[model samples]
Target: MDFGSSLGPIRPRRSGRLGDTVVTYLVDRIVSADYPVDSALPTEPELCEEFGVSRTVVRESIKLLEEKGLVRATPGRGTRVLEPPGWNLLDPIVLEAQIRHDRELKILDDLISVRAALESDMAAATARTIKAPQQQELADQLDVLADLLDDAGAYAAEDVAFHELIMVASGNRLGHAIIHSIHSKARLSSRYNGTPTRADQEQSMAEHRQIEALIRAGDADGVAVLMRTHIVGSWNRRRPEVHRSLTALPTVE
Candidate 1:
């Protein structure tokens, strides 16, 4: 393995969780795609050395990694990265970093564009394949958003749920992965953007209702358009206003 890129520091979190150190470093390498798909993974002993953790800790770390569909371990072959199918792109932790820490988003150009595309495709795929019961699940999420206008955390949670339910209902693996992958981003963006005014709240809820309806009706194209518009328009509309408010000086003439 190449070590040209900085390995930086690997400290076990104070939480004293058994595998935190190994987990953290492995996460970085995996997300960085240093552990290419289908490639054999470093031995648990190797990770133990790099992380200075016990063998048991490394075992636990590998277990979690495998659970996330990142790797497969055989008796003799050792652990290896799974092909594209094994990866759960929609994993919340993964999406959180992608959305919040993505430096490219500083300009809000192409990064936002990637998010927009993800939403569009996700909604469309959900609309195409979501079944009756799943549509009901999506509707319940809409009800939550409608009733709870003040609880930002609750609202955000439901928002992620809505997308997850829709993605599952749509019955598309990749679409499910996309929504899962960006699930945290959708929530974080909502939280940072915070509770909107009554007017904005109504408009947002109505938009969600519209998407839900389209999915129930199996209108893939329409749901796709509505979801994309809502996501892009949100960042476009709010971020600028936020920037101006933060940067502007208050003056009394």
Candidate 2:
């Protein structure tokens, strides 16, 4: 195979470090299945030539790929692309690449399910523990969402803020951190944040108001149910129609 053509043009350098560029290009190839599972990556010298980077940079890039579980390096066998199950999906680079190549929308579906599960639990926690001031803050965020209903872009941004505030109020720092990392990267995908109509935004705002009411009333169970419903429902409404039949997305209990 013509590895250079398969990998496409070397990306323009985005930083002073050449290794980062090489790593990103190689990651794109591996995740896109340009280099399929168990396939050997181009030899170091070949990579160096293709990427126009030094052998040292190529080696470091391979090292980074290995660290991300995208490849395995052996002294005599060279580096081979690993199976998808082995990949460090949480790594921003890997996740972004996977999202780009997720033709079936399976990853995005799974992403929404995971987000719903975590955010629902966090919402429950917040409802149980929120004091008057925190309740007021969440109500204020709902007001912000209402104001942005006419602006899809701004509404989407504040939509995220409203969810994050609930996560923060939950006091589940680990859940909050996990959601923060994945949600930010997931938003980069068009499929994940599908274009929302004004009607869609209005529905979402109404749901947000319901969530805030449940939280303010200290109804943890109600909040959890509504939070999960809101998230999964929003995704269903905006989910791209192109691949709807390919696979059914998992549901949250």
Candidate 3:
């Protein structure tokens, strides 16, 4: 790798920590295939010189990369980039890098599938145990969604809020945390959000209404199926045509 040209010096402006900035830089390079799997990374001295950081910062950044399963540093062999399968995809920084570099949309597709699975179950649980107050909450949220139909950006934000309400109603903290972490990062990718037409927003709102109705009626199975279908179908509609061959979740009947 051309450390001087391709990878520029780190700026003086501090973000969180110097180590974090360096980690982000290296993670982007590794995930983007600038440093391919099985290839050794630049030496510590080279990295230190390139980023203009001290040896301590570089070493700590390397340790952070190892913790994320991005690279392995052997005493005699230097650091070697690891395969994607070994990566901690749940880590926010690593996941963001992967999503940013995902040209074929495979990572986004898989992200939707995982989201569908977890959120569907959460929806079902909410439906089964939701009280009258919780049902009213969802109904009010649906109203808010309907009102925002004209503003796609605001509607998109509320769309996430509506789903989060359901997840909270389900009382599944772990599930909520996992989805929140991944979805928060995934939303930063343009491919993940896509460009929603007015018709698309209307369709999504309609699905939200149906989901609310099912939850109100305590129809767990129906809500689960609809939630899964809604998520995967939304992704299908927005996904680029060229990469449609990638596997997607099947909608439950």
lDDT of each candidate versus the true structure: 0.65, 0.86, 0.87
Mind giving the per-residue lDDT tens digits that candidate 3 earns over 60-129? 9999999999999998989999999999999998998888777677788899999999999999999999
Single out the weakest 10-residue window by summed lDDT for candidate 2.
244-253
- lDDT by residue for model 1 over 1-253, one digit each (tens)? 3222344454555434747545655655665456777778789777777666778888888887787777888988888887655555456544443344333344244445766787778788877777777777787788889887776556656766776676666566775665455544554553336545666666778888898888788888998899889877766655533343343221111
The sequence of per-residue lDDT tens digits that candidate 2 reaches over residues 76-174 is 988999989989989998888888778777888898899999999999999999888888888888888888888998999999999988999999999
* lDDT, model 2, position 26: 79
TM-scores, one per candidate: 0.54, 0.90, 0.90
Q: RMSD, each candidate, Å?
A: 10.1, 5.3, 5.8
Q: How many backbone clashes does candidate 1 have?
A: 5
Candidate 3 lDDT? 0.87
Question: Using TM-score as the measure, what is the rank order of every candidate, best first?
Answer: 3, 2, 1
Give residue 239's error in model 3 in angstroms: 1.3
Write the number of the candidate with greater TM-score, choosing between 1 and 2.
2
The residue pairs found clashing in candidate 1 are: 89-181, 90-180, 90-181, 130-169, 130-170
- The per-residue C-alpha lDDT of model 3 at residue 68 equals 99
Report the lDDT of model 1 for residue 192.
Answer: 39
> 178, model 2: CA deviation in Å?
0.9
